[model samples]
Every structure is written in C-alpha cells, then in structure tokens.
Target: MLDEAEDDRDAAAPIDMLERYFAAHGWSHQRDEDEIVAKVKGSWTEFELRAIWRADDGVLQFLAFPDVRVADDRRGAIYEAIGLINEQLWIGHFELWSSSGILLFRHAAMIDVEEAALSLEQAEVLVDTAIDECERFYPVFQFVLWGGKSPREAIAASMIETRGEA
Candidate 1:
C-alpha cells in the first residue's frame, strides 16, 4: 500500500533495515546467499538466516510483501504467516480466520507491503497478516442454506419466501 512519496525518502528496505539494525548492536545477520525454503500445510515459505550478535534496541522494523491470494479452506496459512511476523516483531503470536481477498495493506510497520517485491517469507507473512486482521475486525460468515434443493434454487426460494411478496 506504500507509494513512492512515502518511506520518508531515507529508509532502508524493511529487510535490510533489520540487518543494519542488528549490526549497530554488534549483532551479525548471517545467512547463506542461497535461499532458505520450507512449506507449511502445503503453503511454501522461503527464508534466509539473519542473526543478531547483540540484542536489538527495539527500534521499529518494517516488513513488506506484494499481492498474493489465498483460498478459504487454506486458513491455516494465515496463522503461519502471523507466527513469522511475531518472530520478527518480538511480539505475542496471533490466531486468524482468513476470509477475504484483494487486501490492500498500508501502514504496515511503516512499510508499504503491496509495493514490496517481497520474498517468499514476506509474501506468505503479509498475505496472511492482512487477511487475518481484516477477518478479526469484520467477522462475516456467509453460506447457502439448503433444504433438499440445489444451492442456487435454495437461494432463490429463500429470498422469495422471505421477501413476502415484495
């Protein structure tokens, strides 16, 4: 959701900031140049090792990811991404019930998530985070009620019966 005008014109990429941040504390973010990959519940996530030689100063860190779509049945993917954000933020974990699509995430840790060409880890975490937060804030469950009828016909009948000649 971030734009070119944002980011204060003087901030490192969210990921790079994490590295520089740790470095100031004498912590080292060491990782193989190659990518670290993993899959959770059939959703693929990739990461690389970035270590801290010293404890972080609790400075605000940003993380971003571009657009990604998740299906309804794969709600667990949302929780998995939440765990990753918790790890990065050093915060309590969260639970989610992802329910929407086409999330436009802005003001995410001061990072423009949608604008970021995020890595797999970033993509997974962000896609899930946005979905989870939206669902938590606006919980809506919609389904068709059937009475031995096709869903389409059931919907029509229900609407007609409830309208009461309107």
Candidate 2:
C-alpha cells in the first residue's frame, strides 16, 4: 500500500488486520526503523520505505524499503514509463513478517498482487526482479535492504508484523 518513495518510522495508519496480528503474537522490539526518510508513529517491528533513483545515464531506480528491492526500468523510460504505467493500477500497502514477528517485506502492490504470502527467498527474487525491471525501463535501478535478515525473515516477520499491525 506504500509507494516506493514513501518512508514511515511507525506503522502506517491503516490495515487493522496488521495491528491485530501483531498484538496476538507479541513481538515488538523495533518499531519499523530503517535507513531512510520519514518515520511514522506507533510502528511495530516493521517500517515502510520508498525511494526513487535517477542516474546520469538516463536510468531510474524505484526502490522500496524494508525489502529494499530494486526494479530496473528497462522498458521505455524508468520514471516516465514506469510511473505512467503504474498510474493505471490501483496500489495498496502490504507488510509481511515471520511467525515470530520480524519485518520481512513492505511495499506497494497491485490490488491483485499484494494479497498473498511471500517467502524471504521469493522476496529476494522480487528485489532482483525489481532491479532488473527498473534497468529494463531505464538504464539503472539498484536497492539495498537495510537491517537484519529482512529479506530472509520477510515471510516469517510479515506474519508477525501483520499480527502486530492488528
């Protein structure tokens, strides 16, 4: 539900399911903190991060945190093309965690794509794909997922973060 350029130190003011899920488990060590801009209030163990990169070679990288996956805009134009294409779809913010409530992945997904479980490994691929996708559209797009095993613990942490959000 959060864009690739948005960052929240606290949990987003939405998604009751996420809040309830977290309370049910009880894993609130870090309130969604990462290396980025803007932190919201009442964050659990996960935070949403988003950023856009423009390279001198006419390349654009749209990256989102906590997953920190990079999407290569290798289609037409990274910003102009991907931004235009993304405008057509309805996006929503989604967070996923492990069974123990560790942050795994957080990003904007198409209305249809965000409603599912994604493992850490799969999330890694997603990051790779995002980077490659960005490269495809533009010329470059790379991302880094700060903090611990966010990529590996994404699915497990998401399960917990979702509960925390509840």
Candidate 3:
C-alpha cells in the first residue's frame, strides 16, 4: 500500500514540475485537475497550449492550437499539406481534429521521477518545438484556406528561402 502511494506521487512529480515552470515563467495558466492550459504568443499566431500528465501512460503530452480554425471545405487540402509538412519535421506533428475542424500541433515526452527535476526544461523544449513547427507551417494553412492554393503550391510558397538578412 505504501509503495503504491509512493508510485502515485512519483507519477505526479513531472506535472508538479511543469506547473511550477509555468508559474515561474510568468505565463498566465490555469490548472484543472491533471491538465494545465496556457497561452503562448508566437511570431505568426497566438497559440493555446494544453498540457496533460497521463499517469496511466507515464508521459506528458502537449497540444498547441493556433488561433485559426479550418473550414469544412478546406479540411482535405489542409490535411494533405499537414502531411507534407509533418514529413519535414523532426519532432511533433500537425493534426486536425476532424469533428471540430480544429488544427493543432502535438508532441509528448516520457517522464519518471528521476528526471522530474529536469521536467521544466524538457517541457520548454517541447513547447518551443510545437510553436516553431506551427509558426513555420502557418502560412501554408492560410494559403490553402484563403488563397485557394494547392497543397504543393502553398508548401512551395512557404518554403521559399530568403537570400539575405533584413
């Protein structure tokens, strides 16, 4: 019984570390049960982050949803474009919540109490990766939804390399 209780605390230690990290970073966040909801300001769009500690799986997962929501008519194109973009990504991937037509970036990292002390830093890396991937591909989403561009065209337009610094 005592061992079981200790295991429960160990499982929750990562979440506790994440919550403290959010507070220390001055991010306005609310904790609800086992999840933390916060807002992240990105270069291309404002993103809402939902982080949940799934004790059953012993992993911390994060979902970053941008301000833009896809329309029903554009879902297919957006989905195709996400597939292309996700291929280029090293970690995390874009996904559309079909029922709601909400697109988001998702990623997860495994955790244990031994690494709980570094949870705060690891969480930051996960958050940064999610935000960077979303911001990088945000233009493709806009092109497909508003510009009426094909998936390939949108990806090409967004991938154009800059020649020189500003």
Return the top candidate by TM-score.
Answer: 3
Deviation in Å, model 2, residue 48 alpha carbon: 13
Instruction: State every prediction's TM-score relative to the real structure.
Output: 0.22, 0.22, 0.85
* Per-residue lDDT of model 1, residues 1-166, tens digit only: 2223434224544444434333433433453222211111212222222211111332222222223344564444444444443444332233342455422222223234444322334433443454343333211111111133333343344334244564
| Candidate 3, 80-154: lDDT as tens digits | 998998889888888999889999999988776354433344756877788788888899999999998999999
Displacement of residue 136 (Cα, Å) in model 3 is 0.8
Q: Candidate 2: what lDDT?
A: 0.28
In model 1, what is the error at residue 166, expressed in angstroms? 78
Tens digits of per-residue lDDT for model 2 on 1-166?
3223323223232222233223333423222322122222222212332322222222222233332233342212223323433443333222222233222222332212233232333333434443333323221111112222222242234323233543
Against the reference, the lDDT scores of all candidates come to 0.32, 0.28, 0.79
Candidate 3 stretches with Cα past 4 Å from truth are 1-12, 113-118
Which candidate comes out best when scored by lDDT? 3
lDDT of 3 at 78: 91
Shift of residue 43 alpha carbon in model 2, Å: 34
Task: Rank the candidate models, highest lDDT first.
Answer: 3, 1, 2
What TM-score does candidate 3 get on C-alpha atoms?
A: 0.85
Return the lDDT, model 1, position 138.
Answer: 19
